[model samples]
Every structure is written in C-alpha cells, then in structure tokens.
Target: MALNIKQTAVAGTMESSDVMVTVKPAEGQGLVIHLQSNVLTTFGDQIRATVQEVFSDFGIRDAEVFLVDKGAIDCVIRARVQAAICRASGEGFNWKGEDK
Candidate 1:
C-alpha cells in the first residue's frame, strides 16, 4: 500500500557528511523534489535517483521533497529520506518486509 502523508516532516542534519530532507504531503504534485547540493554539477542525477528509489520502495506517488545535501553517501541519503517519509506518514517502517 502507498504511504499516505499526513503532515510535513524533516530528517537528518547539515553536517559535513550528512543530508537534510523535508517531506510534505502533496495530493496531486506527483513526487516533486527540490534539491540543493554543492556537488550538483557532478552528483545531481545520482542523488535524485537515490531519492526516487526510496520513494518507489515506499510506494509514494505524490509528495513534495526538499533536500539539502552535504556530501552524504547513498546509504545516508536513503536513510534520511525514509525517516522523513515515515514521520510524515505517521507510520513505522516495515523492517521485516525489506529483509526478504
């Protein structure tokens, strides 16, 4: 089932090796992402693809995502996105399902 976002939520930090992500409900926006990263010239597409993959995993189709990157790796980015999504949707992540 798709996650139904109920409110805006944020995760992560602006630390040198971290990334901050904000998630908000957008009924018809269809996964809008606003990203700010100093490394955009080189890693923009990869970063966006990582975020998109997380959204797809959670079955999210509509939402507004604001991300501020600080040279974080793909795993960190995925974790932050998932955390924000879970908080916004007021749901706990299904850890068991992911192990399969």
Candidate 2:
C-alpha cells in the first residue's frame, strides 16, 4: 500500500487551506489528505507532518489528499486535518466554510 495524494492549488484566498480527501472504495484503511499552507516558515511541512500524524492512528497506507492552503497557524492545520478525517469517517462534522 502507498500513501499518495493528488493535490491541487485553488486560485483564491490562501488564508486557510482546505482538503478534499476521497478514499478508494476497495481499501480498508486508508488516508486521503488535502492540505494547504500560507507563506510561513515551514508551515507547509508542518501541515503535512501533522496530517500524517492524524492518519497514523488509523494505520492508513493508501489515500489521495488534496490541499488548498491559506494563511493559517500550525494549530489550524491540525484542526483542519482532524475535521476532514472526521467527515471522511462518517463522524459527521461540517466543512462548508465553517469554523473547526
């Protein structure tokens, strides 16, 4: 299994990045993360690492993550990833441009 994400950059405010993850129907445990980062010091790297951390719990080894980053802090990165993961898992949160 491999963890891969087909990411795309959207043309708009990069203040807060968004992820649109879709897991393959056949897969059992997978991680799909779409992450973005603003022009900050190691922010992108931090977001990626944080996302991976979240997936680590599920032992996710397959996924396609997309990221659209806005100017956000590390905490925001973690929160967004968690939110997406929650939504993906049917935990039922909200991703309609709302707060985490």
Candidate 3:
C-alpha cells in the first residue's frame, strides 16, 4: 500500500483548535516532520506520534510533512494528516477499512 506521492498537498486551517498539514513528496528522504505548535512543550510527542501513525497507516515511507498546530485535538490532527497524505498521493481513502 505504498503511496507514490505525485505532488504536494495541504489540508486544514490555521484557526483556533485547528491544524494545517502539508505533505510533499520526498523520494529518498524518508519521513521528515516539521511541526510548529504552541503546545510543543506539552504535547509535541503526542502530535508527532499521531502524524507518524497516519504515515504508517498509509504505508508512506518517503515524504516530508509540515504541520502548524493551533491546539487541535488528536482527531483533528489525524484527519488533517490523512487528508493531506491522500491529496499528495492522489489516492482515495477507504473510510470503512483499515485506514482508521
């Protein structure tokens, strides 16, 4: 289920309690996450873990992710990351399947 990312994509917004996620193809670069969040000191690990989980779920092994968080919860982060990844990969999600 490895995704062949064709272009960069973004999802979500910068509103309060929302997060903006950008996914880009990085052919040989493995997964690289650049995150900026106000709660970095308190929830950085959790946020990164969420993003990593999404990447793993999509079987994405090479890509660069940029995330700007505005206090978004776990679900929001997961959705945004998933959306961005789908857009970048030009793939449709299987909402009722194992992707969740």
How does each model score on lDDT?
0.94, 0.50, 0.92
lDDT of 3 by residue, 1-93 (tens): 778778999999999999999999999899999999999999999999999998998888899999999999999999999889899989997
Per-residue lDDT for 1-100 in model 1, tens only? 6889889999999999899999999998899999999788899899999999999999999999999999999899999999999999999988897779
For TM-score, the strongest prediction is 1
Q: Could you report the Cα RMSD, in angstroms, for every candidate shown?
A: 0.8, 7.6, 1.4
Question: How many times do residue backbones clash in model 2?
Answer: 15
User: Residue 27 of candidate 3: its Cα lDDT?
Assistant: 91
Q: What TM-score against the true fold does each predicted structure earn?
A: 0.96, 0.52, 0.95
Clashing pairs in 3: none
Question: Which runs of model 3 end up more than 4 angstroms from their true locations?
Answer: 98-100
User: In model 2, what is the error at residue 83, expressed in angstroms?
Assistant: 1.3
Query: What residue pairs are clashing in model 1?
Result: none
Q: How far is candidate 3 from the true structure (C-alpha RMSD, Å)?
A: 1.4
TM-score between candidate 1 and the true structure: 0.96
Candidate 1, lDDT over the whole model: 0.94
- Model 1 residue 16 CA deviation (Å) reads 0.6
